[model samples]
Target: MSEAKSPQSTVDVNTMTAIGAPRYGDGSVLRTEVVVRPNPRPDEILVRVRAASVCQGDAHLLTGMPYLLRLGFGLRRPKDPIIGHDLAGEVVAVGCEVTGFRPGDAVFGSVNSGAFAEYACVSAQRLAIAPTGLPLEEAAALPDSGMTALQGLRDVGQLTAGQSVLVNGASGGVGTAAIQLAKALGAEVTAVCSTRHIETMRSLGADHVIDYTTDDFTASDRRYDVLLDLIGNRSLRHCRRVLAPKGSFVSSAGAPGGDWAGPIVWMGKIVLANLFVGQQIGILLMRPRRTDLEFLAGLTAAGKLRPLIEKRYPLAQAGAAVQHVLDGHAQGKTLLVV
Candidate 1:
């Protein structure tokens, strides 16, 4: 793993510029320049990033999917020029009044800006300690995907012991975490992934693995109390066919399109239909927070939860890593070594 560079004597941290639109896939998005933003604000902690993960979500952000987001981000550019979401690093500087951290403490968190650089600033509330035995690359994969998985299963889906939960994108980042967390929560888990990934999900404790290429899961005779569609492919009408009575649906698969509209537009139908139907269609944004992160970290430390990192790329090769995620065959979380 690469260590983060210290702030230079002159105050410039070598940073990459997110100035260009990705013409096509990840290959077109290049990090070839350095930008030095003024040091972080008072409420922020500047971190020397040790490692970070390349998520599919980051790919969508780069591609400017969800057309609505561009208006706020930039008509043709990203508002946060340098983009990345999950980060794990040592604190290099802390603002006044910041507690629970010091300059050298190893920490992991999510932030709103520029995670792809050598140094990133994060809010104190979004970060938590990296477990002593955990690798920086592993812990870096936790915040966004991990929090989404845990929050989706418990808070959003209301998953319970003996309850059956089906995760559609069961081999991706959030899907991998959700499978383990659902099993840890005592739910009967079913995973939907490619045929090549069936055994992988089984190793993670999925009770059943349905290969989408071979057969359709929603077309199956079985029913689930919670249908978690991380891929966001199903329309409300199609999804309703598979839900059990009073079941809920939560979608994490973001769309690639005009502005920044989410799959919730389709989910909105699930909501309206629910008023007259028996099922309780559900959807909400996943917030990355310390309380939920600590729980995930504890699970990782104790062996109940683990990241299924399909691959790792160095900082220079980070664009390739993003491309891999954009290609959409990566089995789980993809990480970027500093």
Candidate 2:
């Protein structure tokens, strides 16, 4: 982490550049715009964003898929025009109630919808000190995927040492993080990806790597204690078949479906099926917490968690960066260098 000069001495700036989604649409609808620089609230801090990573959620926000999300985000247009959430940067200014952070301290965390900007205001409760020696861009990748993986396996799945977990769609951002976090928790990890990502999963400390292109992992006789599904393309029957008698099924997303309902339709099936099965079935929508960010930082400092970054793009090309993730072409995390 680099402790450098602060961008603002006294919150004097009035405007900054940001990627704006004026209306809900695809990545093509995103454009660069000069927006007002946000001032920190009483419980927020202003970050001079050095780097931010593109996530699948950003794509959803762009297109407003799963029309259900619009109820909260917006009915017709996004409540916020700016895009992105995961960010890493230096603290230039703090709110009146903020503590433990000072100007020039390297920090990383998820913001609501303004991380793609040159500056963003983040709630103090959502920010954490960046791990020692980790690059801001790499640390930038940790907040969203890392927290989802940690909460899904440790909190939702109740994974423990000597147990086993099989991760489907094991080459994307969340999948890669789950593979390493599961190992750190002492659970055996079987990563399921296509032929190209088999080696990527193994390099992330997965105990077993299933090539989904050449074989059907669900057909195997072996069973696992937990099934972490990042891609919800497989039917529930196929998913439950690989779990142990008391195993748990957790999904963060599903295959692209109708634009109006999207993956939520699939997620709803998991909830409806949970009542009839002996195996626990649930969907994970991570609730980000400061404590979880601290835990992930500790793991990074101890070398137990290392975010795998596959590509870097300039802030000007954020649209393409987001499209890459939406298209499911990125093998790991995709970062935007501001």
Candidate 3:
């Protein structure tokens, strides 16, 4: 561990190009503009962003969706205009109180906001050293999706080796990460995706690939010990039918039940249903941790875990990258390279 500020680096920290949403609406609201670069606080570090990923959460923030979200985001517009979370880059400055990292360290992790810019300030607790052998683009895609899958399966679903596990939406970012992580955990993994993505899922070590186009996994006679529902498209009853006794069902996504309620209504339904059943059912709200990021980075360094990147865009085209994700058809993670 080291402390003390290094000499002034190559990156200029005064001002930078950033993408911001003038108003909450659609992807169209995102605009590329020059903004003052962020300065790190006592427990923070300033990163010159090399790459950042577009996430479904970003789209939600962009639209101010479910109305209730507006409570935390903003009443009439976004509170923090610049949006993005996952980022990998070089540290250009370190706060005086920071230790174990200094200027010139390559790090990757999550942030509260402002990753879609040349520079971002993140809490020291949320970051870890980037993996030795991973590309910055791929590392940038891992934090949010990787931690979500890791916590959803291992912590929430309580997955055990040799148990049967099924992952829906197996081609998207979280789905792909879940598939690989499930396999790494020694579970019998089944993935559900479109016909075009069947091979990709299989390549990721899925024991079985169900083409949702031609098969209804819920209608099958097979029962799984755990079902990680990433799409949230099917009903709770339908999902329950496919779970074995004492199985766990984790809900991570779906359309908002109401503009004001968002996923709260659906989560309530799941909770009420769990009262009479032996099975476990709940929504997965990911708690990002540095330990989880380090674990995933080790897996990446060892060649056991890999991020699937679908496309890349420059900082100026960040809005388009977000639109690609909002389209609901991206095969993997989308990136905004600075």
Across residues 1-338, which tens digit of lDDT does each residue of candidate 3 receive?
Answer: 11212112235547788888878977777877777888899999999999999988998789888898899999999999999999999999999889989899999999999998889999998999999898876799999999999998999999999999999888999999999899888899999999889889988899999999999999999999899999888999999999999999998986468778878888889879888899999689998788999999998898889999989987777767888888887997999888
What would you estimate as the lDDT of candidate 1? 0.78
**Candidate 1 runs further than 4 Å off:** 1-26, 254-264
lDDT of 2 by residue, 96-205 (tens): 99999999999999998899889999999889999986887789999999999999999999999999999998899999999999999999999999988888899899
lDDT of each: 0.78, 0.88, 0.88
For residues 61-175, write the lDDT of model 1, one tens digit per residue. 7876666756766666776667788999999888886888898989999987667767788988888988767887689988888899998889988999989999998999989
Question: Looking at model 2, which ten-residue stretch has the lowest summed lDDT?
Answer: 1-10
Among these predicted structures, which one has the highest TM-score? 3
TM-score of each: 0.90, 0.94, 0.95
Error of 3 at 17 (Å): 0.8
User: Backbone clashes per model, in order?
Assistant: 10, 0, 0
TM-score of 1: 0.90
